[model samples]
Target: MDRIDTSVAHPARRYNYWLGGKDNFAADRASADAIAAAWPSAPVAARENRRFLGRAVRFLAAEAGVRQFLDIGTGLPTAGNTHEVAQAIAPSARVVYVDNDPMVMVHARALLTSAPEGATAYLEADLRDPGHILAHPDLRATLDLTRPVGLMLVAVLHFVHGEGAALPIVRQLLDALPPGSYLVASNATKDFLPPQIAAVYDRMLTAGQTDIWPRTRSEFGALFDGLDLVEPGVVAAHEWRPDEPDPSLTPADVSVYAAAGRVP
Candidate 1:
């Protein structure tokens, strides 16, 4: 393990703060509060993203019959993590969580314990290096590349700002899995939101503490190329087959778009 620096405000730590977790530091809280002040729905959006993870994991395990998961950008572990949701439905599920954040790595090791029937492993890797993730010794030990693994990208890709963005990185990851593997992802979107909100968000992320890119629905959908999209296509994170009535949920409440697709 490594010593975590509490000096800078990291995206994952700040996200943990937004989700009401105590693993974050004062710097994280301050940045989160500042962002929340600019976009009041941020906290709610973080919660919805977590809910979406639960719902999607359940569907993938119980209905889609997926038993392997490779969750990239796994933030600081909190309640209802990917393995917990998947293995709850199917105890034999195997999950490999990847993240580059040192703070998240520390917390994940402490909090993300696997069930007896299932297995869990963590990789200190970056999403930018999908090759490293695919070749990680721990990942190879825990997951079977021949099987249908569920690939979870979640709200992590936008940090890859640029014209090409993280699309190539995504392709590299998706290319490794065997056929029938699933690609599940969510990304922040500027669609259906005020330009002012988007502008503020852009400025906040550009402060060099975090990476931010707001894509249109089509751009987000393009990430699933050569895969079969499940029902409802790419839509609002909360609307992508919500489980509970979450009266607090609204389309605009979350700026993220989520979807699941199966590789042909």
Candidate 2:
């Protein structure tokens, strides 16, 4: 547990706190509360993002017929993990989950159970080093690069600060997968937020109070430039083929855009 720092606020733990999970430290709770103090709808967006992940996985397994998945930036396991959602539809699906957090590894081993027919492998890796993630032994053992893969970058790209940093990383990972592969990505956006609220987020980001680097619609669209977008492309998180349609959630409620796209 030397790697697990209870005093710091990790994104996964902070997200878990936002989703009302009990696997968070006081630091995470404080960070979450800090965000919520300015943005009262933070939890709504968190729940919507989680729900979007499930819908994306189901689409990949049930409709796209993808049997392999590389879910990078996998936060602390809660309900409807990538493997669970995919394997439920395709019993023989194979998944390789990647995350940078050491604490996530501990919680994942206990919560992320796999189907007997399907297999799941966890790796400690960072999204910034897509090369290492794609070449990892555990990933190599779990996924077949020759076949199609579902590359899940959900709720993770925002951590990669600075302009044009995430695009190359995304492209590199996508290049490794076959033609039939798919990409499911979601990132927080300030497009829908009114100027006053957006300024609050901006000020927080500048003050080092928030780690998430919100992206513009054009910037996010650039991430999927070479791929063919799925239906209802690039909509709000809760708007992306929700399992149970929630009319109450407007674009401002879930300031995150979610979409799935095919490799070729």
lDDT of each: 0.86, 0.90
Taking all chains together, each candidate's TM-score versus the true structure is 0.94, 0.98
RMSD of 2: 0.9
Per-residue lDDT of model 1, residues 147-261, tens digit only: 9999999878876787567789989998899998999898877686788887777777678544557788888889988899998889888989877666776777888899999
Residue pairs clashing, model 2: none
**Clash number by candidate, in order:** 0, 0
Question: Please, what's the RMSD in Å of model 1?
Answer: 1.7
Query: At residue 154, what lDDT does model 1 achieve?
Result: 85
Report the poorest 10 consecutive residues by lDDT, candidate 1.
205-214
Looking at model 1, residue 229 earns an lDDT score of 94
What are the clashing pairs of model 1?
Answer: none
What lDDT, from 0 to 1, does candidate 2 have? 0.90
lDDT of 2 by residue, 91-136 (tens): 8999998999999988888889889998999999999999899889
